[model samples]
Target: MIKHTPKQQELQNLQQHLLTTLHRLCPVSNGAAPPPPGEWPTTRQLAESNDITIYQARNLLLNLAGRGKVLVTPGPVNKSLRWYPSL
Candidate 1:
């Protein structure tokens, strides 16, 4: 079986918590899902809304994207990345 270091486990826990919080705060929790091709908020906005650091938000979203739980798209102009839940 695969093994996870202590830090890895801690990060995983944090990611789960963040995702749970996101689901609760967003429309996804109320059966009013976000638009399929709607615009997603920036990492900074997510961080602010979730009361977490930008780095933490970015890490959590990136982890979700890596797992195919979310979608990551390149932003126009500045070329930054934006994330959306896979709902």
Candidate 2:
């Protein structure tokens, strides 16, 4: 059996909430066709779309990435990191 600390549980809950919010914003399609690869969106874009702070967006993406639910790509020099939902 796996054991999780209190902090881990809290983070898990936050991740779930974030996933739900993300799905509501950008739903996953269910059809014969799969989503295209390399569809990373910047944190700023997500923040603007969801009316959230950039910090919140970045943390959510990082937590999602930690759970293997998204991919994080560091942008070019001095650019903000971009995040993509795993398809």
Cα-based lDDT for every prediction: 0.69, 0.65
Look at candidate 1 and tell me the lDDT of residue 3.
100
- lDDT tens digits, residue span 9-85, model 1: 97887777666665554545455666533355567767877678988888888889889887666553244455666
Candidate 2 ranges with C-alpha deviation above 4 Å: 1-39, 75-78
After superposition, the stretches of candidate 1 with alpha carbons farther than 4 Å from their true spots are 29-33, 36-41, 48-51, 76-82
Worst 10 residues of 1 by lDDT: 74-83
Q: Tens digit of lDDT per residue, candidate 2, span 1-87? A: 899999988767766655665566556676433333334456776777766688877897787888789766755323767655555
In lDDT terms, which candidate is top? Answer: 1
The TM-score of candidate 2 is 0.54
